[model samples]
Target: EKRTLDVWLTVNPADYDGRAAALLIARDVTERRRVEAERARLALALEQATDAVIITNTDARISYVNMAFEKFWERRQSDVLGQPLTVLGAEDPEIVFDMQKTAMMGRPWRGRLRHRRRDGRTVICDTTGNPMRDEKGDLVAYVFVQRDITRELELQEEYFQAQKMESVGRLAGGIAHDFNNIMTAILGFGAMILEKMESDNELRHAVEQIVTAAERATNLTRQLLAFSRRGVAQVRRLDLNSALREMEGLLRRTLGEDIELALRLDPADCCVMADPGMIQQIVMNLAVNARDAMPRGGRLVISTRAVSLDDEFCRTRVKLRPGNYVHFTCSDAGCGMSPDVLARAFDPFFTTKPPGTGSGLGLSTVYGIVDRCGGHVEIESEIARGTTVHIWLPMVEAVGEAAAPTAEEETRGGSEIVLVVEDESMVRDLAVRVLSSAGYAVLSAADGREALELVEKLEGRVDLVLSDVVMPVMGGLEMAESLQEKYPHIKVLYMTGFSDRDLTERGRRVPGERILLKPFTRDALTRRVREILETAKKARTHTEAEPS
Candidate 1:
């Protein structure tokens, strides 16, 4: 191959020899040119790379840093060229020592580290260091490639939190399922005993208190279910003002005289689709949280209004949509939360209060309830300033004339053959007592399997089956399915504390399945049974009257 050459001329000898001759020397520089081009290519590649690149001498002194490193470290190249590599990210002494030892052996070291930037901000990064060797095979330098992984770590934390919540949900759901059965017996027997007591009897008041306490216990379990996202919401178009009004006295009593509980009700009705009991629980939790935050007493303001959110407003927030919404706000002038505390306010079992003082599910349950109701909750707080929680729920028109419950209707009952299926002995006895007192022939079973045998041998005479959804041997849904095949005329009612999602997962096939929650009052149980029995009788009469 032909190639161009670098040439040099020697003319001094010609001058000395009085214009005699000149000598020329030529050398090929192709290899030198190719090496320079390769070096340039590598430098350009390092400059444009996204991951940070740093070069340090064997002594751990920084020698060169790429553009990416300069930006990522928030420093100029000149500022860090002669500094120790430790200045870049030696937060963990052990990690740095391990990396140094590994690099010295001409090996590679990789790790995730919390590194401090030049600007003093800490960041999580995935970093790798490889030893660079000279032609003699002696280590000369160390090359480091690092990537900012703060967002990745955050995503991983969120995923872990989600997994944790799911685990907590399952655990809470299971506990609540069994606990509900126990509470049912407590509340049911309390109500039944109180019903038989004379109004003037001294024991009547004590019995009434027992029933009240049982109801409160039931409420607590429901809150736990809410945190697990397994609690069902009985939604209604409710006036926020009315609900708050009803809770004012209870809230006042709970907050005590030192804390001022103020209600800023809207002039116009603030109607939203929500579960009334769940909404009350939300207010109760928030109020209790505010109370705990202000041990010295502070002003707690509960307000409601109708607000219109535009697309622009919705764009800046998550879990929000542009529409008219009922804005419910609870603001408290109490010791506020730090950024760290606020960030994890919705994490289950995460609490700032002393152990046993709080279950730490207050805010998490509120978050779950608002989310389930197609709403969003936003919280704002500063270190010393107070905190304000803003909840926005989609507004709806006021529902037409809701009939108030009368005393007569509350105690109403019916004559029907009702089968009660529950695994708990106390709960089964309570159900039998309540139904028998309500003029119904009540049959009891310890489990669904036993209930199935009872219904089968009863020869289609059972008018309704009020059964617990979960039990040993067989579940309520399975037994109900079997009953449907054998005695299609029988009505079924499923009572459970499990979430709707759980019910579906357990293969609930009854269309529009009716589920009455646990710890239901005697009146509630009797009224529901009568309603189902009446509906069934009317259906049977209609079917008989129809041309078959």
Candidate 2:
């Protein structure tokens, strides 16, 4: 094998006793050359590394810095050389001292570290610092490795916030669903009592107050349902511009004369598939909130832009994906929120308004609506400057304008057989009383399985089945699927506590128009049942007249 040999040579010539003498010496320095080469390579690698590297002496004074470190700190190496760690504005003096102590003890100190720049900007990094020792075990220097993780930390915070919001939403939804049953019973029985009471009765006013309170309570539950994403949504593809323009008049009126509403809509088509009512709720809630903020005169600008988000644009936001979207913004020149208040803006029941003035579900409902539509919402505000809320809704292909709904037919009492299924005894009893009083044959069951058993024992014709959505043993949707297999042509209607969309049996869906919402008056209960039967009768007549 060939070996590299570095040599040092010296030659001398001298005259002694009139005679010339020459002397020569040579030595190999291969190992010394190899070590020097290695040191140069290591230095070069550190200088070119992406992560910032800093070197300090045993006393914790800055000795060297890589190019990356200079760039990360936005300073020149000349300015930082021979300076203490404090020169970097490390924020916490105690933390720095502790880290140094750990490093001096021949242990690595690693974790998230924050550095404050002169510009008042914070730089969060995943930092690791360790002491370097020589062969004699003497500590020589300390090396620090820091990777910028500021953006990553921010993204993690957003994810945690989203999880928190989801948890609160689920809690609110469960509570609202249970409350819906109580409201339905109260409203149904109270309305029936009022119908029988004389107009000049002494107790009429008290009963009316009770009914009014029930209605208002029902509305509060509705808001809670919205925040939980448990409200009914009849979604359809519609133009965003038209939806806003239609609401312009209402928004202006809601904002009052003090606040001027400005509509700056994009000329391009901004079509999106969404519930009209949900869209209306989003605008109205934001408008009302902005109006409250302004108290005095101010400008409220509502604008939309058809934007195409690329992968780069969506990378920072975990909830967003790259696609065409309508960038809807509502900005108001009014007193803005502080950082502390903005942090909890999407939390359910979190409000800065005085008690009884705000239900505190407005912004939370806005977030839930956007989330339900597979979109994202963001808000930014500064004290005394203004507040701007941005929403991104996915765009859909253009479709024709939706047709206006037809007028309702007359509601008339019928003698058809009706089956009502409900888990709540109060709601079930109220439904039975209301339908029986309307002159219809009624059968009731506690749950879907019980209803099926009742139907099997019946010998008469069952004209319609009205059932609640959620129940023990068997749910309404599962029972409906089973019944349809046996009696395919029997009329069926579902009444739910909240959210028709949330009802599904192994991914099965029903028509939104067929599902009725809870907290109905006595008249609504009878009227809806009659309407379904009437529609079924018309369809049967039309089928018979058609050519076979």
Candidate 3:
């Protein structure tokens, strides 16, 4: 085959004996030319690549940057040509040192990197830096490829935060359940003690003090339950805008004269299904945190808006679902938290204050309340740059006001057969004694499993089943489900210290389900039992009266 070969040739006229002579030299250059062309093609590809690419000198000074790098850094190639890598990032020193060390050792470095842009925005990047070398293995330059993963990291953080909050909530709920069971026994028996003692009894004063201490413990347990997302809140469909307006004065008074409270409420009613008191508590908690943050006084702005969270918006949030949301934000112009502090800001009992100054449950309670309402919570803070708490509650159609409690005449005693199922031995003993004293045949069981066995053996018809929501072996809901099949006519009265999502949803309760929240006084327990039995009696009478 005939072929053409590119060659380098040089000819000079001159030479031998001063006569006409030519000296010529020729060498092949085809491979060198082809290699140069290939290099140019690769360089162009890198220039247009989606990932940012930069070529730096041995000292890490930028020598060249591709188009992608220019756009990603928001800086021109000309401006950054002679600049050091620090011009693009004030990254963690350790990461930079490690990357440099690996590259200097003639190895490629790959890692997650923190970078900065021309606009001063922080970015996270998955970066790979390779030490480019000549054929002789001599180091020439450092070539780096970086993919911006800032948004990805944020989404991951949101997911992890949701998981952490949920785990903590479960722990808190468990603790509250245990505490509530103990308090139920203490308060129940104490009430029984006081009911018998005369008004002038000397030991009655000591017993009153004991009851007072137990009541205080109950309040603490209530707060813990609130943080656990299993709170016994009296929820109602509330308009966020109007609710804030009503709370503005309390917030202002709480902040005192130095701090200013501002409300930028949405004109459109932002209604949500939440406990009115819980809503107040959430706002109050945020306000108190803001006030403490700004000890020297700063502006605390609380804003609300009706927002629709689309799939894209909800995708990053683990617990959040796409829907209409009431966006409630509390922002403060004060000394904010550092990165370390911000990470654990939502943790229960995590506080930055001096000893005895804070309990650290404020934000956690807000977290639980929002979680219970099927909402999202986010806190953004930077040292000396202030803090902002963002809460998104699922919006609900405004219904009529919270239903008023049904009026019924109080009952002193009842002859109905009552079955009490409680896991705590002391609580069970207390319930048995109280119900037995109330002139009823009270049956007792340790838990759902035992209760089922007890029910099966009983020959007489039990009028009501008083069961604890949470118990060992089996839960109240499971027992109730079984009861529904076996005894459809028997009435059920559920007693719980904290809320149970499995029993019923957090906000909405079943219409006819009767719940007695602990630690109830003996009178409250007896009254609730009698009420359910009486209602059942009327129901049976009406059923009999109806023509078949």
User: What lDDT score goes with residue 350 in model 3?
Assistant: 92
- Candidate number with the higher TM-score (1 or 3): 3
Clash number for model 2? 0
Residue range 1-548, candidate 3, lDDT tens digits: 97777899999887799789998999898888899999999998998799999888877778999998877777889998877666675377688677666655657888887766666668877889899999998888988899988878887876676676667666766677677788888888888889999999999999999999999878766666777666676677789888888988888999999998889988887899888878898998899999999999989989998898899888767668888898999999989999898888878789998998888888988888898888989988988989999999999887566554444455477888899898888988998998899799989888888887888887437888898877789877678778768888777888886665423543334333478887888878887887788787888899999999
Ranking by lDDT: 2, 1, 3
| Alpha-carbon shift of residue 261 in model 3 (angstroms) | 5.3
Return the lDDT, model 2, position 291: 88
Best by TM-score: 2
- Per-residue alpha-carbon lDDT of candidate 1 for residues 1-548, written as tens digits (9 for 90 to 100): 87675444343334535766655555556677778899999999999999999888877778999998877777889988877766665578778667666765668889977767665556877989999998998999999899988767756765675577688878877787778878888888887787778999989988888878888778777777786667877777889899999999999998989999889988987998888988998999999999988889989999998999999877545567999999999999989999899989989878999987888889988987887788888788877688999999999988675686677765688777999998878878888888898898889898888887887788889989998888889888888988899888888988886677566667753343387888788888887787677677788899899997
Residue 96's lDDT within candidate 1 is 69
Shift in Å, residue 399, candidate 2:
1.4
Query: Would you estimate the TM-scores of all the predictions?
Result: 0.72, 0.82, 0.75
